[model samples]
Target: MSSHRPPPVPPRQVFTDPVHFLAFGFGSGLSPKAPGTAGTVAAIPLYLLLSGLPLWGYLLATLVVIVAGIWLCGESSRRLGVHDHPGIVWDEFAGFLVTMIAAPAGWIWVLVGFVLFRIFDVLKPWPIGWVDRRVGGGTGIVVDDLLAGVYALVVLQLLAWWWQVLMATA
Candidate 1:
């Protein structure tokens, strides 16, 4: 067993490197505890900003982020000497955006999507867990979260639809 652990990463490093800044979710990933959750929290503002665009526009932007996240995450991890380091959270940003895609418009929906995305991300059910374990490089870093987002999106849409039906009946 190698006792040599990687040196502690300086928060300033994220600012110094553009890729690290983004991969760290604009520094939100530097949180001392539960940086993944912090990264997801940082994504909320971005979701609000992008939610106003047309569906296609929103999707296009998300697609761009998702594709770029692979490189951003990979390069940052390589520089940091850690593969998918907890602080490299661009994947969480892309994943949260995926969860909020077409989500019902309201604070409640936002909260629900956030909770659902967090749950799925932390749980890493089935194929998500498989990908997380078997995949490598940036794709490995981002794909698991993407799958989690898809799971959250499905559940969120279902709950929104059911709620609408209930309101109509009421």
Candidate 2:
């Protein structure tokens, strides 16, 4: 057998490695408590940064992240020997992006989207919860959040439309 030894696992840095990077929303997931909340909270600045881009640009970035997130999350989970740990939250970022599509481009809508997305994400209603339970690996990690984003998007759009109708009727 060869004499070479495997490299040592590095000590956890504040914001290095896929697990930490993704778990914290690139650092937001590092909060002492409620990492998911922190991850969602961390998404705001990114949202602000991306939301300013043209819709196409935002859409492209979201797609890239979602694709990359599958690998990152999967690799991290395999290394850690865990499934969908709380800190792996690139999924949340993708979900938030989904929630914003065709959404009102304003802080109010963003806040509403954030809250709604979190609720749907945590509750995992119907198909969202179903996918989370049935799927495995990194694909499972990201799919539930994607569905949550879709749910949030639909609900927010309907609410906006209803508000508009009410305003017109008034």
Candidate 3:
């Protein structure tokens, strides 16, 4: 096998592949810097829409996106010939969605979740980093973000509880 590797194609080439299109988070992933953050910002509107649903409905929607993301991420990775390209950010969308599952109904909660998810994703503490390195394919692309979302979810819940306590005591 040749050890030679071709140069990366321009990020905009994703238009040629529908799976890459979604994996790029509708071009938010094309941002020159912090594509993951850009993708998370894009996810804000989607989260708002889904949050309006009943708890089970929101959860079901999250589940559907995660399932779709696996295929989209995997295919995108293959088509681009790059594993976990920084620009392939469907993972960010799914991660933010995971963070907001059954979240308290408030814009503040949404903001908190966003901040927390980004932190965990960037930091990749413990098992999050472990999965990011050891896993492969679409599962690898999306799983780390999902784990970040779970960590953010727990922190958000704790903050919500504390806020309620403060409100009651005030």
Candidate 4:
């Protein structure tokens, strides 16, 4: 393997390519500060649109994003001549959507999902860290975040259940 690395890509250039545009999380990844967080934040609007769909429809949409994201992210990485560049945040987009799956109908839940997803994605507990270290290419890039989303999903679901029980008692 070559140790040579490509020069940093300009933010404006992200818009020039459709794949890069998407892989950059619609430009959210271009943020100089905390691109991953920005990318996850960018996902919220899309999630709002997605949340309106039927459960099956939502799942299908999420699946499409995840599958397409692998390609989008991989291609962008190649073009950038980097591995998992910070600006490639389509993974974050897919991961956040995964966290919000079957979430309760409320902005509060959206907030919870966002926070939880961010935490796991950032912390990369357990197998999340394992995958990030060992995996390669786009699958490697996105899989870690996907696992983070799963972790968040479990916690989010449990919190929702507990909140429901508490409400019932009230």
Residue-wise C-alpha lDDT for candidate 1, range 36-137, written one tens digit per residue:
999999999999999999999999999999999999999999988899888888999999999999998999999999999999999999999999999999
Candidate 4, poorest ten consecutive residues by summed lDDT: 3-12
Candidates' C-alpha lDDT: 0.94, 0.80, 0.90, 0.94
Candidate 2 has which clashing residue pairs, if any? 23-87, 24-29
Query: Model 1 compared with the native: what TM-score?
Result: 0.95
- At residue 62, what lDDT does model 1 achieve? 99
**Regions more than 4 Å wrong, model 1:** 1-7
Candidate 2 Cα outliers beyond 4 Å, as residue runs: 1-11
TM-score of predicted structure 2: 0.86
Q: Give the alpha carbon lDDT tens digit for every residue of 59-102 in model 2.
A: 99889878987887787667766677666677888888888887
| lDDT of each residue in 1-170, candidate 4, tens digit only | 89553455787789888999999999998888889999999999999999999999999999999999999998999888889998899999999999999999999999999999999999999999999999989899899999999999999999999999999999
User: Over the full model, what C-alpha lDDT does candidate 1 score relative to the true structure?
Assistant: 0.94
Q: Put down candidate 3 lDDT per residue, 54-76, tens digits, no spaces.
A: 99999999999999999999988
TM-score of each: 0.95, 0.86, 0.92, 0.95
Better of 1 and 2 by TM-score: 1
Q: Each candidate: RMSD to true structure?
A: 2.0, 7.2, 3.4, 2.8
Candidate 4 has which clashing residue pairs, if any? none
Candidates ranked by TM-score: 1, 4, 3, 2
Error of 2 at 104 (Å): 0.6
* lDDT pick, better of 2 and 3: 3
